[model samples]
Target: MAKAITQIRRVDPTPEELQAQSITKIIGALAENGESIIKMLDIVSQLDQTGILDALDAILKKRVDVAEIMIQQMNQPTMHKIMKNGMNIFKFLGSLNPEQIRMLMDGVGHGIDKATARESDDKKTSLWSLGKAMKKPEVKESLTMMVSILEGMGESLQREKDHVH
Candidate 1:
């Protein structure tokens, strides 16, 4: 019976004992957080007392719950992590020996140059080449303007592509 009572006493925290333990923990925690908590409390008190809270309330009241797809798209941490991991893999690949990388590059590049050469050669023989080659003033002016716009668009596209990834 005394053993059961002792066990109960050992297991149970009395109100005073629990309170004392809680106060000790609080003191330890506060000691660790003393400076930061004081600053945070001061800042929060100022914000609440000095009408910043009112301004925040007004701002929130004005906001409609319109879900922005673009904002959500920008904040995709998973996609960021995936991209980061992929880039890390690429970097790990890049750190590999030059001979192996060169072999891989050579294997992948085998027909690529020929394919690109063929495509560019096809575009070289333009339909307008005959008309534009004649250099008629009207054709020349129109072609010049078209080429200028194409150049501008190409520059803009290249710039955008450069900035991306």
Candidate 2:
């Protein structure tokens, strides 16, 4: 009968072997991604030439200071008001119909152009001329829309007042 052995020995790789293995893997990866590595190097070279790399490095090194300064600036009352107003404007725009806004902007653009042309012609807008303009379909439609908007605004104000009381 053959003798039975119970001891199990594990041989760990030497430091040199591990280093060689890592180098081999890195070389394989570099060879496989040569095109990408070259493009990355080109971008790095351009950034360096423009001094952007140095600026980015400096910013990264002083990130805490940069963050604090930015925070301080944003914490100012004017900044707070600007941010609030911006958010309110965005919210209002989000609630509006895009097509209606587009049409309104187009009308405003045409009106400005017409007004400019009239000014260049040195023409005065008399009451009679205004009455003639009001007779136009476009003018009538615009007036109707304006009155509707004013009515809606008045109703909103009245509702807010009633709630306040």
Q: Which candidate tops lDDT?
A: 2
For model 1, the stretches where C-alpha displacement exceeds 4 angstroms are 1-10, 54-165
What residue pairs clash in candidate 2, if any at all?
none
Per-residue lDDT of candidate 1, residues 1-165 (tens digit): 344444433578899999999999999999999999999999998999999989888767765533355457657998789889999999988878999668657745864786578787756666777766558775575577669869988998999999995
Q: Residue 139 deviation, candidate 2, in Å?
A: 1.4
**Candidate 1 accuracy as lDDT:** 0.79
Residue 22's lDDT within candidate 1 is: 99
How do the predictions measure up, each by TM-score? 0.31, 0.72
Off by over 4 Å in 2: 1-5, 113-124
Write one digit per residue (lDDT tens) for candidate 2, span 1-165.
988888889999999999999999999999999999999999999999999999999999999999999999999999999999999999999999999999999999999998888889976789999989999999999899999999999999999999999
Q: lDDT (CA) for every model shown?
A: 0.79, 0.96
